[model samples]
Target: MNDGGFSALVVLDDLAAPRFSPGAAELLALMDSVADACPLDSAALHAQASAELGLGDFGPRDYEERLEVLLAAYRDAPRLSRAGRVNLHAQFLQLLKNRLLFTDLLRREPGIAGIELAPPVVIAGLPRTGTTHLLQLLAATGRFRTLPYWEGLEPFPLPGEAGVVPEPRRERTQAAVALMNDAMPHFARMHEMADADHVHEEIALLASDFSTMYFETLTEVPAWQEYYAGHDQAPHYRYLRLHLQALQHLRPGPAGAGRWLLKSPQHLEQLPVLAETFPGATVVITHRDPVHVVTSMATMVAYTDRMFSDPTDPAGTGRRWAARIERMLDALQRDRSALPPDRAVDLPFADLMADQLGAVERILAMAGERFDAAARSGAEAYLAGHAAGHLGRVDYRPELVGLDPDDLRRRFASYERRFLPSEEPLPVDN
Candidate 1:
């Protein structure tokens, strides 16, 4: 545990160390008890826990131990609060429901196969650099099969006739959508999220192991970020491939429809490993001014933290994001040579935003696929329906997000020269 580098801030009070609310503590205890009784393999347990926590494949290792400590502290603490208790109860209920659903699915379909995700055309980039909008645009082409939010949540039951009807699964997605609106009504404006037809990252499948970067943003815990950044995520993709096969097995695809279109910033760090695993895979890497990326991502992280935790600090969040991006970029620079030329393509954020249709054409062209007139029309329709101003509104200045603009420019000078020399430098307020 000492070597694990679980920061004192994660476990202490705001001024002292990281402090857990009583509800968070109680939820931890309930999970620990389940883990103790299940006696399952680590990966299986992780998968099960991920389903339960709504954490979406991002359950931490030593999850049991962490739970026990929180539970014990909650029980012993003299100042246990009502809000803490209520929060814990809600979390526990959700976890229980997830575990039951996951277990039942495994029992019903023994030896389930994973999705045969064809070589994906992945979009990787720094946050707030037009990656999301690009993915959504690409998904509209109909040539790519994106794992929609609904299917990702209910991967056990293949979406088919059931998908056509207003089923419980559909209801769940609607409920989630409603909750999102309640939590962050403004999010949809910055980046739209829907159940049925959007391209999403496969990171949640990796999150089952708590090794993904999703958790760091959800909770402003520096220790968690440090531990997550250094971990090898190559194995998670293997697991993801298996799950995809399993889900796809249930719903056979129309012939010639391309495999999943995945997107995630975390992929930058694991690019080499990803290439090795899926040699045939085509990758689309997005580039932006590192300073702009850092600042915008910090704003995103701060907003996300507010949804799940207390005492979100914009400065602290910015610092952690800067460090993580630096590491990811460094890894990308080191591993660039490992990727074959034809398999990789880099697109600048400014260029993509300026000419999204052209960008999509180039990306598909690189993959040796031509979008038919119908596909092109579909892409246009999607873009028209889900316009830029519809979701996930973000307006952030570098200074507001605690970044030193001049320093960032110098740090990412080489990257700018190589990938974005022609684009205007992101506006920075002194």
Candidate 2:
């Protein structure tokens, strides 16, 4: 069931992993030589990052719990090329570094803990269902505040940006982006990132705590997934509140910025947690056909997995994700039924693409914000300036990934009937 390149990658992985991702023959040999080296000395990594950042506090060592899980995955991931191992190791260190930096800043400035947050307007639903597009439009309304991509990547300010000198953090973020774009240009085509792009999701912030699907999607880490399957995200949600407040305090936007606009497909899986953390926050849920959603997600995850892994199993990967998505849909249905009517609104993928401005107007009304002519025009201008689905045509066949369209539809039948096209009921008549 795997696609064209799957077997070739697997066959070459153990001996020539660099052939797939690294692209350099010598690096492949080096990877073989270093494959047996120790991975991610957590204490040493933490100490080094702390010294580098000149910060000692790591808030609570609660995140330490995830370190062992990551180490386990690093050890078990098969045919992990030197490049893949190196990248994964670097990411963990960076996450640790971010935790130290953010915690130190928050600890030094106690007032950051008290900054009140506008009840967020969160976008949730299936991947490829216009959540990012909707979030960007909502942010363009200028009525809401969101983090810049760089801020999302590096949430804390450098030591002295209030001075006249240039901030080194910006330069660092830019350089990193450039390197990534150069190294993996195709990834940008699918999920482009830049120095100042709007916050796509809180994934990076969640990664700092290692509580999201950040690692699972990037690699075939079934053990971590199994562990996370039973874990509670309440602590992560609490940390998210603190994290948002820190971003707001460091980069204060307009006096009356409407609210914090957030989006992530992960939200659908944990809607109750979000509701509990930010009570009274407005939620927007997007719906698309399950067949398309499942297949597209598998392909995207496979791309990322291959980048950070080797000998990727397309069939197994797709099967695991398909099952996960089915569970998410089931959870979504239960949560939506339990939610208060005024708390959330459903937006169908068809409606958003067919008339984005109309969808935005409906969203604005749901958020209790005015959608005046200017606001309508702003949303229109946002769409006019930016092409939708800039990833071009994606043709991921469900069968190609071992997923049956009928099975996906059957699994999501109840959800589709309630929220998908022809059944979606928007309160607004716009």
Candidate 3:
């Protein structure tokens, strides 16, 4: 709420001025059409739209003015690429519809003690430290319920039994997968995705509030990123918990199943806050050489940028990523000291890969849980099925991405010394 501390907060008054580029206008128009069809609550709709547009506290008067400008732009714009525009519009509409419905349900049923969410496990680490793979692997164990991409995106009105059939969801997911493959085939090689596979960082849910690091990665908008960088990410975590509660209530899982397994690289930067929110939660910290992490992360960012824009700048990606990782390391260090020793577990990427089963067994042990043979075998089968080739398919050079390998290594020297195995180099590229 206090703008002084956050580098990313924008006074709502300033954001009231309409500043839509041609491309942004086109996108906004799509969103408008979708929202119109869905017909969400006006106040909630405005809040959602404001967040999407990255408009901070312009107060009530400014909110109306800004919304008018945005609506006018959509009304005046000519139809764009039908396929792309329609898809974007539909996605936003669906998102708004779900959020509004969920919010209404929560309000109406204030007494609803949603299905209890417990035994929480949070997978957190620097980007490209194998956090994604680890999450998918853990999800496959069947001991935990992970928020699938589809469910996470649409967490309202309770998905019906007809929707439970995996076919429709799988088909939709496959289509999106095909599009991504067509657009950026290189990414699939690095990260294998299936319709049922677990995804990381439900940022879209957080994006509903415009307070997320995801905005930075989506656009080359430094001003917006700077505003978010300084703000507290704790609210997003709170939103996550509420949604998880809603999801559990809507879709009860197997009897006595533990709480949701949530994974996100962003969680690393808000470790202390996350611990405070979920005190009993099990936290798994993944570690890897900083240099390799940067390189791998830059490549992934480069690939993602290509999907939405032209001319992905690898160096710019690396620099932004480096800054974020730096913040995360700082947070982790501070939180590690504050948290009880038993609540946290540190793991090496290399060790996890070398013996996936053993690594997971130890992790579960640390969390005070035991894995049944079926869960263990399921995890093993998942690893064998996914394979290592899927793990870092995109070979990237730190130097090519404008990263000085030595400098990066030096920057994370303290982290390496404290967490990395003695035999491993502080910033080993490979």
Give candidate 3's root-mean-square deviation (CA, Å).
10.7
lDDT of 3 by residue, 1-430 (tens): 1123212222211111223345555554665456444432335555664565343333223224323333233333332223333443444445555555556667766654454668588888877777878888877777776777666655553334335556455456566665555544345544555454446456666654445566455425555555556667776677667777766776665553566778877778777778877778888889998778877776566555543333346667778788778777977877776556787888888777778788788777766767888778879898787766533333466665678988898898888888984654333121
At residue 179, candidate 1 shows an lDDT of: 58
Give the per-residue lDDT of model 1 (tens digit) for 210-255: 3566645554445545455555667666656666665566665555
lDDT of the candidates, in the order given: 0.60, 0.71, 0.61
Tell me the TM-score of model 2. 0.86
Give the per-residue Cα lDDT of candidate 2 at 157.
60
TM-score of 3: 0.75
Give me candidate 1's TM-score against the actual structure: 0.74
Higher-scoring candidate on TM-score, 1 or 3: 3
Q: Write the per-residue lDDT of candidate 2 for residues 1-430, one digit (tens) a residue.
A: 1113311211111211223344343444565567445366777778778877788788788788787887777668774556677767677777888898888787789998788988888998777676767877888777788877777777776565543245556667777776665544344434546455545588788889888876777767778888887899889988988898888887776655747888888889888898988888889998877777787777666655644566656667678888888888888888875546897888787778778877888888888888877677777787786674343333455665667888877888887777764843321111
User: Which structure among the candidates has the greatest TM-score?
Assistant: 2
Stretches of model 2 off by over 4 angstroms after superposition: 1-38, 160-167, 421-430
Clash totals for all candidate models: 31, 0, 5
